[model samples]
Target: MSSKLEQKIAEFRITFIAEFNDKLAVLTKLWSNARTSQSLEAVKKFRFEVHSLKGSSGALNFLTLSNRLGIIEEKIAPCEEQINSLKTVIPFIDRHMNSMNEASRNTPNSLLVLQEAASLLGELRDPQKNKEEITPQSYRDIKIALIDDNENTSAVNAKLLAGFGFTINQFNSIEQLEKVLQKNTYNLVLIDTDNSTNPSEKMFAFAVKLRTFDTDVFILSSSSSFENRLSAVRSKVNEYLLKPVNITTLVSKIRKNFKIDLIRPYRILLLDDQALVGSFYKTLLEDEHVEVLAISKADAIMTELESFHPDVFLLDMHMPNISGLEVARLLRQQAKYDYVPIIFLTSDDNIKTKLEVLECGADDVISKSTPPNIIVQQVDSRIQRGQEIRYLASRDSLTGVLNHGQIMDAAAHSLRLSKRQEKPAVVVMIDLDHFKGVNDKYGHLGGDKVLVSLGQLLLQSVRDTDYVGRYGGEEFMVVFSNATPRVIESKMNNILTAFLHINYTVDKQSFNCSFSAGLASSTDHEKLSELISSADAALYQAKDAGRSQICVDVLNK
Candidate 1:
């Protein structure tokens, strides 16, 4: 095989291994959980992993592997059978996964075995069907209303949606539509701007009211006028379909705007001097719903930028001539693009240079010294941060945490995730004991040094998935998802030990600062305010019983 194809195969093997590793980790965690909740979560996670692998293998044209994975996914989705069933299959699955890892371009028998296993899965689902089993559906019954004065357009649009299993309501005018909306609840409302009372004004008012019901509002217009599209967007229309809509495009827009199986592929731009580097990144990123743009030269970046408006810029900082930092600066300066996040990849071990590049506008500076997996993770984090910033308010300058208002928003988000995942998520409330005494003893600058050290320490020690925010002056809150009381206590102990080591210097004079933390888990359904209150009560207890120690209070102390 040629070198390029060989590299591609190697990358695929790595991705397959990583995915299996992730599933194994999740399965291990599920097995260790309490019996009451074990199967449900384990089954869900297992199914999700297998389903993901099925699609991935299918896309790669690994028919046998895809088919087998499909069967495994189906079996695990309804893992209601005893845990012994899993125990029995887990060993076989592990061996098969290992076989995939060992198999090469010449391993046809392994492929045949995978195919047979896949075929057997269909038999398990329905013994009669000798064919592949269709995956179970989770289609939601969505009610949508279309308002258009034109009879022909409304009928055509409604009929098109009916084929997709949507229940459609048709209205001839704004007045009729208003009455229908008031009388019935709809998931989405489609308005034809051409037939509105005052296209701009009425559309805006309708959008506000429709949004109150949390329904998606969309505009259908034949005008195709830029002004009309702008007005529709201003009126908070989720999307606008131009007149003489192609049925496919219209259906796609409807499904996409409504988030109905409209999964977007992640877009990754890989810039490197080496063709192998770009190809490797492309292969890895493509497996995760990503569109990879591999460019080898800094000069060709503009061409790629024009054709592919990538969500992220993964630029090589060591590129000749105009470096990644230079390109990043240019991109940020452009009026068309300043929001696009840039992550620079460098082999240089110098931290000072890396910090300078970050200051130059790169969102993240990742070392090429790390593994490819770490590189992918760092890129994912940078992209996730950009997405999160849209929903989060400005972070606090002092504590580097979400300010007062943003904390509630983050708490609510963590709460929902905790409940859905059925995992333990904890909130740790921390307060500096005798904070005022320290400020008085060491001066305000010394107090500031302590807070900065605490922030840095927390960010460094916590898991990447965990969130830490400055709740207020001398107080911080941590959102620890998928964490237990013991795990959280261990983390807190580390924090206390680390805090003791931090040497705070003010005016070249050294000083010391200490803190106490209290943790409460989200095992029960409690409000965000209530979770914090419980944590705060525990914090008080820790403070009352000598500070600088971690405490977990089950009683609402």
Candidate 2:
């Protein structure tokens, strides 16, 4: 097995041991209560606890513990009638607890006992019977609006979008599009500035108007004039496509902007002993589209952290055995969990107490009596801020694409994933044609504008699964997932042609620029370094052939 797989198994073992200890503790308490009071309620509680433990143990592959719990459960299956007989099962429960404690300590004898116990339990039931089935969610209908003066163009665009399960409404003019926007909301709006009869300023104004409604807007234009591109930026256009847009690229952009391909549910871990209070908090957060896992046992923290990987931890100020502060300190000691957000939920409103909680490694402390809405807002804000900080760290300062080191790291990771999954990927290296002329003639500011435009273009042009990065000054690298050589060549060609239309003005004179690109796919090489070297060789070939063209690396086997 690979080291990665071995590490994952080790992590699972740690979590399982912790959770088993917690379950054992709970069972011990319930067993003691049942022994003292031979009532039907006590018997029912004991049986239920044993049944839960049996299920958890089996799932975690602790067959010995599971089998022992199963025997105890079977002894109490008669319910109230077996209440008085439950005392006879106390020895078995105690033995199981002892075994679990030894297992937690990684004792060889306990491990041998567990293996023997598992062999005995093999006759009870199929171990795989408890595996859960996962069902895929159905896709929702997406509504899109297309605005263009040309009927043919609008119809073609609408038809293509419709094929992707989008309900498209085509408008022949900006006036018609505006009228529909007022009455209905759309997931996306595609405007063709070149096909519009309205002037450039008027088209930009309409885009600005659409932004007010918080709808994702994409511009399809044949013109990439500096003025028009700058206007699109100011109008907050989500994507700008050069005229005669590539249908595949357009769909990819729409999916990315609307998060159609990203269904990331925010995961939250709630640590509280108060069952009722924990339920309330879970329900409130779930209503806001958050996935919450609540654990009353403080010892089970490691288990939930490993499984759920929560974005934020909602920890109670006080928990039995382990206080929230102590738990926070323990978590801080672990390198993997050092940066995770821990918000203390407490009823104590004393300022001194809140400060003390913060000192104990809490990111924030909130009163339990605070309104649910405010609590949700605080949690959501903190998660969002954390995401933004992470995003900024990985991105280039000027272009918002991945920085040089990040891009290389991303490429290496992607290559490993592709190799494991047996999927194909393409790497395209791009260099601006006559970029030094732009800097020398139009000045460095003009060059910066060109770089920013290309950055935005690359970002908007690729699929969400693809990675775009600023490799260096005027060079960019794009890693396209699950793409073939043909696809990479076609896409890069489209981008190159579109780039030529981007006009920049210096003084009263206007100029345009283009880019040369080289493509290398998974078929060409297995290693990321080899792929990059192949693409770089191709890029040099493109530069030698002409300044504005794309060359595919043909590796001789």
Candidate 3:
């Protein structure tokens, strides 16, 4: 992230906070009137405000505040909805109120709950207040506790998850887990419920207890009954997965749940025969948070190109043997590098030489004699504008992931690279389970929110090198480069576990929806088209077997 861009987002936060406070004041006034008079109109108006606040706060990532507001919203009186009694909602309004004028607002029943909720909103928004809550999660350093009576399953899952950069500890019972959790903190816990005949019952009873320790608890059980699933929800379980779970799916779920905001710096590959000139330029760009790899020899270009993956290339127009023009032409020959911005650094200001440089496929020709700060500004602006253009052209308008055509292009490029590297590339085809029902129940707007959340989760769960693209409505595609077939399938399941936990609200009612994914890898197929077809076929298998599950390509498995 650039300093300017960060500043702009900060400005947006300021505006949002100001607007939020103003609305909150109005909401409080409405609540006070409703609590005193029990007026139906005031009750309806204040309830709408609560709904709006909950939605907006969650949308802006003020999760702690939004969740509290959600709990308060759910307390809306049923009698008031039926117009049976206006007095029914007074208790709720009083309990959730934060009245500045009323001294007795903090009664035993009221508890200043709304006051705390409001304070939490400001705390989450301020970086200095409870900084850890607002900071990017340390995904790599995630610690997990797994409780499974089956020691074999625990050992196997623990080893696999630990191999993929996680600290996983296995406990045979809730008693053992509880003892360890007293002294050590974990990000999440996996409960395999097989101790009793009812599978999830005993472990499900422990979920609320585990959550009290400030750790997310996920239940893995063989029971797929609706009652048991509902029980898991009531227990405040983060996710409920079926038994015979895919190890990779669990890995992906944990990973996606612990998403981090990784800001990638602009990369500039500078080639200048003069050591002093190259070093000077590198230092200037580095100061601006740009990654600069200065190479004197043109032969080193190919070696560094694969690793550095520069966003912009700065080539000396006059090199020892090869000029910038020749290098630009060579790079332009590759289809993938066609969009990579190349600038020529020249000592000569001759119009003919500049024209020649542009003719050879460089985006622009800049004189080496130009001011250093000016050069930095020019390079930075070009990279920003080019990214903006690419974003507009290739991203899905609604979800902001890569559009259909761009994803296809990415898949093609990914396959070619995977083949060259002698590594497998995996493709996962995802579709929201029973999405039409969501549209029917909550309307299309609600359905769109689900898709947007899914798209964001898909992008966040993977590395920057991976590709996430919107296939169409309620459908998506993700491509993982240099992935193993079975291994990638596990990673592909990350979004599935994460998505189901996303609660969507409509008209004060909240619900969560899950997605099914089909994962196929280059282990069995070579062509991109074939790989995608297999993945699509596997996706249908998942949908057929049961929704909210991931199916791996049969051949690859």
Give per-candidate clash totals: 3, 1, 2
lDDT of 2 by residue, 1-557 (tens): 22343344345435555455556668778877877787788777777667555543443345566566667766676646755666676676667657666665676433522454333123222222321121212113467788878887787777655543468888888888777677899767888877456898887788888878867788888877888789899989888889676665565455445533222566789887765456656765775667899888898887555335566788876554567889888877865455568898765446876888888877898765454446767988876555445445666765567899878976876786677667877888999989999999978756766776687678768875688999999999999887788878988899888878877664546788888888887765888899999999899999999779999887621
- Across 333-382, the per-residue lDDT of candidate 1 in tens digits comes to 86445556788765443577678777888777765434444555677767
Instruction: Assess the local accuracy of residue 526 in candidate 3 as a C-alpha lDDT between 0 and 100.
Output: 76
Cα RMSD (angstroms) for every candidate in the order listed: 25.6, 16.7, 26.8
lDDT of 3: 0.71
Q: After superposition on all CA atoms, how large is the RMSD of candidate 1?
A: 25.6
Best by TM-score: 3
Q: Which stretches of candidate 2 lie over 4 Å from their true place?
A: 1-372
Clash count, predicted structure 1 = 3
Residue 178 miss distance in model 2 (angstroms) = 25
The list of candidate 1 runs beyond 4 A from truth reads 1-394
What's the residue-level lDDT of 45 in candidate 1?
Answer: 54
Q: Which residue pairs come into collision in candidate 1?
A: 222-243, 266-289, 266-290
User: What's model 1's TM-score?
Assistant: 0.36
Q: How would you order the candidates by TM-score, starting with the best? A: 3, 2, 1
Q: For model 2, what is the error of residue 74's alpha carbon versus the real structure, in angstroms, after optimal superposition?
A: 32
Give lDDT per model, in order.
0.64, 0.70, 0.71
